[model samples]
Target: MAGIAIDGISMVYTLPGGGEVHALNDVSIDVDQGEIVSILGPSGCGKTTLLNIIAGFLSPTAGEVRMGGTRVEGPGAERGMVFQQGALFEWLTVARNVAFGPRMAGSPVAEATEKVERLLTTVGLQGFGDKPVYQLSGGMQQRVALARCLANDPDVILMDEPLGALDALTREKMQNLVLKLWKDTGKTILLITHSVEEALFLGERLIVMAPRPGRIEREFRLPFPEQALSQPAREVKAGPDFVATREEVLSMIWNMEEEIMGQAEADQG
Candidate 1:
């Protein structure tokens, strides 16, 4: 089971000046195998901090993260990450970038080559194997990043604003591609994004977080992602149910932001 369990997680950063910043407060979440979950929150809400904790890149001051019933103490092959910048080696060819993981793991040449070819085709980059990553468009670079992450065959994929850099059309296309990949691979995915619409579209479960000592504000089980599997994403987004949910979530975040600003003003005054 590739399910994730985050229990009683909290993070406190000790500032150099003698104070402490409470980044997260007893945040706990359970993600079942093959679940696609999206997290949203205002800036400083610790969304990325939570993700980094789950990725084992940072340890919480209290509590632990478990995957497949084992505690996650550090990064492992069972997890892969896709970043906002499509963090690929610009000097490497697309195929080489995708194959980097398997090669590092000492996969046989023939097997790794086969995997790379299949993944390129999976990501719609089949014929562009030899092209340097720098030569690709932003969207194409992201596709390569996706393929590279898939190459590792991780049970879980962590994405932090993976589509945040793209234009509208490209972002929508990438959103659909994400759905397709999730459907085809059945990998557990936890994505952090600022876009409420994207969160609703890609997540079977959507989580909203609040800032001051960050914690889960609300958890919603949404139908849009399942609906999107068969329908055009635009059509799904246009539906009354989807639109209503998006507005509600937007308002929720907006209110949180307002509260934060008010608090800041009070402190200054």
Candidate 2:
């Protein structure tokens, strides 16, 4: 079990013409072990940028990331990333895709096979392992993605809208799976989503961000996720607390988005 500490992280992008765009500004957050956190914000709010930084795929221009009390200089097996798309290899079977990490790490064949089978079963794809990646539906592909990440037994799972491309029904089902995985595996999770409902449903702590020099704007520690554990997702979502929190977050994001649009118009004018 490990916690992630992101201290004073910021990102600055230099455009081709010598203009500087600040993508993140002094963003800091802590995710404790076995806890789930979700980041919710409008497009261009640096949510993905933040996730990438934590994944060590991008180096923040300033500050550092630490996990389990050690500095994170680059990508490692302890940190797994799930992108919007499954990003699975079309040529590989589902089982091979899930086993790739363990196999590459030099685990013996039997051990890797057992790990793959367990992960497939965990992700609700026990029999689908023999199926090619191209044969699965969007939801199933995302399940494979989650299973592949788990195969590495990463201490922290970073998800970037892993369910964004799915239909409404599928997305709801995936949300339940994520919550179940979190409770069962006790792995720290940081999910980036555009849905307020998803954020509230999956995150014990929710962060809302603002763009144009993206930074954390608001955060809520809510009980909706824990509530969802005992109740059906739909029922939990319909609860008063969920509805109230959803409205509050939506209103804040909408106001921030309006401010962004107004600033853009003024700059053009």
Candidate 3:
């Protein structure tokens, strides 16, 4: 069954002078339960806008989103968001942060504590529970964010560039962790990423969006994610098919960017 359905979604913003900017145009996608999908697009392609609409943080100007046959009206406990920067409360310790969702939901004290502990361990922060979020490194903090999202036991997780801020080595390690968590939890995940390679590695199904008014440009079902699950990520990325696919995606996005730039120049001229 489809976990989330986005039908004919279009978003328009009214400018100060009453001009309108169309951010997304008739974008539609149905993500299956437990699927890992990644979105990639240029700067103005409305990737984040689409994600926010699905998360119920923003209402689209046209169309609607549904989860399990129910129209999404607003934020609910079943959908969790992990932002580019870890949005944890700085004053809260790692344990409290991870426990926030369950605690807010009125879970029994003992149950919430046990869940937090297990999640911390699952995210590799078992011993750092008592530390303030400020004390951790960038990568570790993101791990906490992932655990906090999982603590809610949400059916769908929306990640907006969750690994965008990490250093290269740390980002790679986090990528592996994300795949492991996806495999273990069987949760549906929709991740928005700027990096072509990251999108290729993390997405079982990869979506490329078009510019101007963002819409689905191309979709690819790749074997790399499954391959990376059992083999070293570096090796999987180095395989011939992976290299070929990466080049194809890169060229597609690069051409879109060039066209956008040329259009902007012409408008200015």
lDDT of 1 by residue, 1-269 (tens): 38899999999999999999999999999999999999999989999999999999999999999997899999988989999984899889999999999999999989999999999999999899999999999999999999999999999999999999999999999999999999999999999999999999989999999998999999999999899988989999999999999999999999999999999999999
Q: Which run of 10 residues does model 1 get worst, by summed lDDT?
A: 83-92
Query: TM-scores, in order shown?
Result: 0.99, 0.98, 0.98
Q: How does residue 151 of candidate 3 score in lDDT?
A: 98
Question: Candidate 3 lDDT, tens digit per residue, 106-211?
Answer: 9998999999999999999998989999999999999999999999999999999999999999999999999999999999999999999999999999999997
Q: What CA RMSD would you report for each candidate? A: 0.8, 0.9, 1.0
Pairs with steric clashes in candidate 3: none
The local lDDT score (0 to 100) that residue 72 gets in candidate 2 is: 92
Instruction: Write down the lDDT that model 1 would get.
Output: 0.95
At residue 232, candidate 3 shows an lDDT of 97
Question: On a 0 to 100 scale, what is the lDDT of residue 5 in model 3?
Answer: 92
Q: Model 2 Cα displacement at 77 (Å)?
A: 0.4
